[model samples]
Target chain A: MVYTSERHSHRGSRGRGSRGRRRRHPEPPRERTGGDIARGIVRGFGELLFTAGLLMLFFAAYEVYGKQFETDREQDQLAQGLEDQWEQQEVRGPDSEPLPGSANSRLYIPDLDLQWVVVNGVSQEDIRYSPGHYGDDAVSGGDATAAGQPGNYAVAGHRTPGIFWDLDLLENGDQIVVEDAENFYTYEVIEERTVTPDQVEVVDPDPFNAENNEDPQRSLLTLTTCAPRLNNTHRLIIHAELTDTRPKDEGMPENIADMAPETQAAAGE
Target chain B: MYGLIWRVLPGPWPVKLLLTLVLVAAVAAGLWFYVFPAIDPYMPFNDGAVEVEGG
Candidate 1:
């Protein structure tokens, strides 16, 4: 009886140990073949391409919509800052020169139903947030005059949806208004043309005669932006001559006041 | 690739999901604040202002 019981116990223990060993040890990994390696490489390359395509789409969307949001926010801040500056004494005078990158005046296009606070300089850093005024620092090497002065008041802005996107809609006789702390200067559009980027004479005091450095005989306003909206192959230029000047106390200019905000908003849409 | 990352991550499903969301947000912030602005000057649409030299 003892021998039979011992033999039965030994068989049971051996069976349990073998089962445990099998559970602990798994099968060896299979060696990779050339075809398997090639497949893996192709799959990785496809995933990389897919990721790149996604990134590009996101960037394009951000450029179109995200940039507009940034511009709108900056414009609001700049407009408020201009109003504050005007309230605190006088920010600009006939002889006083405002610092570069500073807000100088409010530009209003009644025809387009658009308005923006123009900054002093036209550098990329200066105009990134708002339309910028031309100065001696400009490529034209000519300084812009005061709002109603007898020289060119050149301005440059991006062709984004919030800024000069509809500048081409402006025609002859359209009014472009500039408002300083004191007066509203209205300019009537005289000419609209496209020119090469090198034609800096468009911003000169005398648009027709670049060599004449003397003070321009007439008060002129020049608006410039990139042509084709999406390309920088040329420049779009609009020339206007001052037609009327009135004190701010006299209320808004006639053309601007005639435009109903609701109508303009509908038209913009 | 995403599945591999998910499997390799050492956490519960909820923790892994939270970490994934954080990673996505960081990438978007980086593109919006740094990468996009840095490349803005090179884009044609942003080159609205005319200049005489290499504008």
Candidate 2:
């Protein structure tokens, strides 16, 4: 039955007797019928849709996987530059302004096994490859202070893989360590919440309380990223307060060293 | 569509195979470096920072 059906299809197009003869000389161009034209148009449209679907799949793959490699390289370079700056003891003074897009500090979320060199400004360009600190001008009528300062040290990063992809896993009481050239400021997570993109108050000195204009008595850290992983309709904010500050010469803080065995050994603990 | 291209190629089977590989690489490179980066800014994955209007 299969052979017969195959023969039927071949005979419908061109019979076996003429197949051999047609190979020597090309057939004359046949006039296209209305049905033939319609079929051609439908097939062309189908092919176009198939190509478009393939392109979209490729783009999604690049966004999820390919982009991670780029971020990894950029992070490595930034970390190296930061280390060199630290080695030279060129750390910026607390009163001196930081250069935009420059790597200023190292951020370590020991629970997440993540570390990134934080940049100076929170602009898109500044945070493209690394988490960026919110500068004083980030929000109108609001002041963003430096790390370990008695104000909000707000930082923002992309939700892509290798960055803040696992930010949602952070819970209250988690330890987040921010290291400047001179000291490591350990922050204890106080709250984790989601807010709308317009809620810039989350980065204010006193989050969610705009009326309180007085100086913040405690040094706080705010990490903002997109919520629900791949979506950006909301922002995920993690608020933490500085719990401990130790000189870099003293080695990694107890909380951070406890999380990593290699670091613990390196610290000679 | 690919079968059509294979039949229309002028060279022998090996040459056609090489040409197909080259064509695939070219398309992949174009998509990776140019098309993807060009459309990345419009994507929602990187819009993580909160911004107030006029702020």
Candidate 3:
């Protein structure tokens, strides 16, 4: 009787051990405490927010710096194209009309070490690769030119980089040299002002009066960009007047003589 | 979510690692191509013009 009972007990223990080792029925989910559930939900939300925040940071960095790479590359191509166009046998005269959306001139700001090939037209497509001239027939009612008739040669660009970013650093009387195929026009900053984004009147040739559409009495240069650096709510405008104009064949202007080597290298000399 | 995926996957370490890499690549591509672009307009990346009536 002792031997039989011992064997039976051993068999029962073996069954219990197997049951513990491998549960036959799936376990019911544990009853989570209210506090535990709340914590889990908060953690999940926090994780989601963290991921979104990281993505936003990456995007901001790309917009600020990465976009510059593309703009620089486009500038190089545009510069090359402009150089090639000038080298061709078909030379344009001083009175030739400037076409919208076409690269027409080079703007050099020695004070800020800024230079860019200016394209005509202020359309988004036109300004994507370079600073765009505010065309006369623009729906915005502003006008710009490089070597055409004497008028406001207003241009718009982004304030981030590779454009008019350091425009604010320029004070009154700074020289802004502009050159096209045939002539160099030097302008001096006369005024600086900040206006709301909607103040399209600032770009008008007669900024004081929108109704005054008479011929421009003097040549003007207007540089416009988003102000306060990252904010686009306001526009920073620098108004300048043509101080000197000389034919390009007369050679590089005295003001930009120091930059000749750099300019030449940039033009792929 | 990632931990749950790891538990559900049935494979040895090497196969699981490879699958994880591919899964990561797909997620990144989806975010880059679709998710980010959808959120772009809401962000202030563009320096687009603002219209102003004469004042």
Candidate 4:
């Protein structure tokens, strides 16, 4: 009887030990505690949240900085296109709009000594130092060079703190260019005019307001920005003439280096 | 009501993982389709026009 009871107790203890382990792990158990399940849920959720947060931060960073690398590469190409411009060929506006991009579509040089690029349209987003057209930078109802005439091709930019701030330093006879995918036109500064915001006619391509006026056909470029340094009431206009157009083939000259954000960073440093 | 809901929803760890994955995916999908393209949050626009030299 003693041997049988002892053996029975040993067997019972083994079963109890196995039961205790199952209680601790509790996989697919018939009954479970509220607390155990809650802990598991909490742990899983915390881990997921942590991973999601990390992924979001990564995506945001990529979206912001990715375009800068693109610009850095294209700057060299833009400079090359400028160099290849033909000496005798004159460039004009595109027959079609250029595809959306941040690189300058064409290169220009009115002075022949200085070359500048026309970012397809003035915008503040891609290039910080751009003469932007959208938002507060755009001077509305500005005259464009009429269909046949070319006198006015006026545009505007911000001056107080951003890219066009240097407009104040621009002098008469300065050159400006508006480039497209195919060709770039060069315009020479004829005069600098300061006018109120209401005076939108100044930017008109045909300021003369004549029908089919040949005078408007003259190659002209106008730059608009806020006037009087830190003031917004008046617009500072720089009027220029289309002196030359260069086709790609003549090749751009050497000595002109690309301006990159790194240049700006260096300036700040 | 909370206790009733909690009792109805068991399988705690597995459910949590699934919910977390769904939430994360939803956010990612929303950003991919709507926020990123519309806002263009990644681009930095700081340049003013620079004069390029030509022939």
Candidate 5:
């Protein structure tokens, strides 16, 4: 640690006398071994695993939150398309049928505080936009007339948050209303059942087959969704009988009074 | 780890800063285009089966 008296030592003048004035401490080395290399590899691998776990966390967050944005965007587009159709077309009556995949109606569940614009087909792509009308013979076709029809008017939706996520929470006697632009068809839940995914018979005209369609006495609403979120092991079915039908000109039904304002507004009251 | 990288780089301040920015942008692009998309299907949400009613 000797101090040099040469003022040129701090300058850029590199002569033999100035070389040793500010020399750094020499590092001890020459300890390379196979074990050290192996330890370094293992440490790097551990860091890689930690980074992988963080990536998985980000991916999970994206799957849960990111997909919601996509669904919401699709729903907004579908809703706008439906509004355009409603404005451009004539008022549909008891005899007219909405085209497949066309936006046809809305469903309001007061107990669950859920409202979704109903699309017309049950295909995966269709339900991705919104709850879809089941177009099997067991259920009525996707027509405006199907609202108050004397047979099963079945609908299917996903169990995700924006869709029928709380459907399994519906209890007997709960009100499920299906509405088009012109009419509101109210259905009171009579039964709830969880069946295997193959149980298409749940959507039959007479789910219990208590009577044939010759009489076609009851107007029914059958709502279905995949049961047990995160897995598709079974189907959750909610069966409701039509309780009332009111025209849009008459305003929203009384049951919709406690619903969100947007819901009430969507009802066009 | 990042400090080790900063110490190891040999350049002027501005050049080092530019290199750091480029590295960050490349990692972000890799995550956005490859890593995230590859792991999406394995996530637990929205994995419903794609089958018609009758089946």
Candidate 6:
């Protein structure tokens, strides 16, 4: 490289002369090719595919963990209830058909007119039992046995006022009459408490006991509702113990039919 | 095979860009029209979802 003096030239000024003096290294503006173009596109598409996969994963997690878990529980119960109902069909009626108007299962209240179906399991379909609010699939009755299992069965309902219509008015000691084929189980409310949602131990099969304080004996009934009325911050629990078991012939009210229409198909009548 | 792609890119940019776009559209359209509809039923398009509830 040669250094040029700052002498003015005829072509305008010293700046033009300086540029002319500098060496120029021009190389055909880089190379252009078809393959290079294709690669960029493939790269872009790969990125799009990766993004799509992430989105799909998010949706799958939402369905299983968030949405389906809350409401699909009823379907689980229905399947289980059907299994139990079918296995226990050891007797035959006059028609050789399951009895009609027998309240597929019955619900009774001596204090109020709140006799409804145990409705197999509490799924999204059975929201009417719990103030019309459906639960996802994962939420079990909490205490199925105490509510009215073979020995102890449990039931849960919504407690929103003007919502469940009947369950909302359920007070402490208020009796819940459960009528199955053979007998009507009368369970009396014994205890009530407020617990956080994660404290699921309260609804365990034998959450309470006297022997080991873990092995349960009495037919226990459990009722659950969103605490503080409408808010779900906590669960308002009502615990009841079985008081007496009377033959359905004696306890079933004159009003309730032997079978409800919903159970017509299940009863096989 | 990969070298062929990188080599072409260094030669020209616009033409490569066009080919990339065409390949993507071809793959996507083929899968969507010819493949997806057959398996759509297995997807979670439950029309009765609203009515069925938990059970």
Candidate 5 lDDT (Cα, 0 to 1)? 0.68
| lDDT of every model, 2 decimals | 0.77, 0.78, 0.70, 0.48, 0.68, 0.47
* CA lDDT for candidate 3: 0.70
Best by TM-score: 2
Candidate 2 residue-wise lDDT, A1-269, digit = tens? 99767655554465334344455234432434344577688887898899899999999899988888888878877866776655544555455666788887888999999888888887777887788888878854546677898878888888988888899999999999998878899999999999889888888887756565366777889999888788888999999999999997898788777654543332232
**Candidate DockQ scores, in order:** 0.40, 0.46, 0.24, 0.06, 0.19, 0.09
lDDT (C-alpha) at residue A130 in model 6: 27
Which stretches in model 1 have alpha-carbon errors above 4 Å? Answer: A1-30, A84-93, A139-143, A211-213, A258-269, B10-22, B52-55
Candidate closer to the true structure by DockQ (higher is better), 1 or 4: 1
- Of candidates 3 and 2, the better by DockQ: 2
TM-score of 4: 0.41
TM-score of chain B of 3: 0.71
Q: Which stretches of candidate 6 lie above 4 Å from their native place?
A: A1-104, A128-152, A160-171, A210-215, A251-269, B1-55
Model 4 lDDT at residue A16 = 37
| TM-score for chain B of each model, two decimals | 0.72, 0.77, 0.71, 0.55, 0.76, 0.54
lDDT of 2 by residue, B1-55 (tens): 6657889887999999999999989999999988897788777666545554312
Docking class of 5: incorrect
- A1-269, model 5: which lDDT tens digit per residue? 23342433433243334353345214221243344477678887887898789777766665566656656767666666666566544655434555677787778898887777788777655776588877643242222126678877888887766777778888999998887767888899999988887676666666667455444567888888878775678878889999898988888888976764776444343
Q: Which candidate tops DockQ?
A: 2
Q: Report the Cα RMSD per candidate.
A: 9.3, 6.9, 7.7, 13.9, 8.7, 14.5
- Each model's chain A TM-score: 0.78, 0.80, 0.77, 0.46, 0.76, 0.47
How many Å off is the CA of A143 in candidate 6?
9.6
Q: Which ten residues in a row have the lowest lDDT in candidate 4 chain A?
A: A132-141
Query: In candidate 6 chain A, what residue range of length 10 has the lowest lDDT sum?
Result: A1-10
lDDT-sorted candidate list, best first:
2, 1, 3, 5, 4, 6
TM-score of 5: 0.71
True contacts kept of each: 0.47, 0.50, 0.15, 0.03, 0.10, 0.10
Across A1-269, the per-residue lDDT of candidate 6 in tens digits comes to: 12222222222242323363333213121222233456668877887798689556654554334333333344334423543553455444422433221113545565664434445444433543222211222223422342344333545554433223244456777776666667667777777777776665555555564232244555666666556553456666667777777774564443334433434443342
- Which of the two candidates, 4 or 6, achieves a greater lDDT against the reference? 4
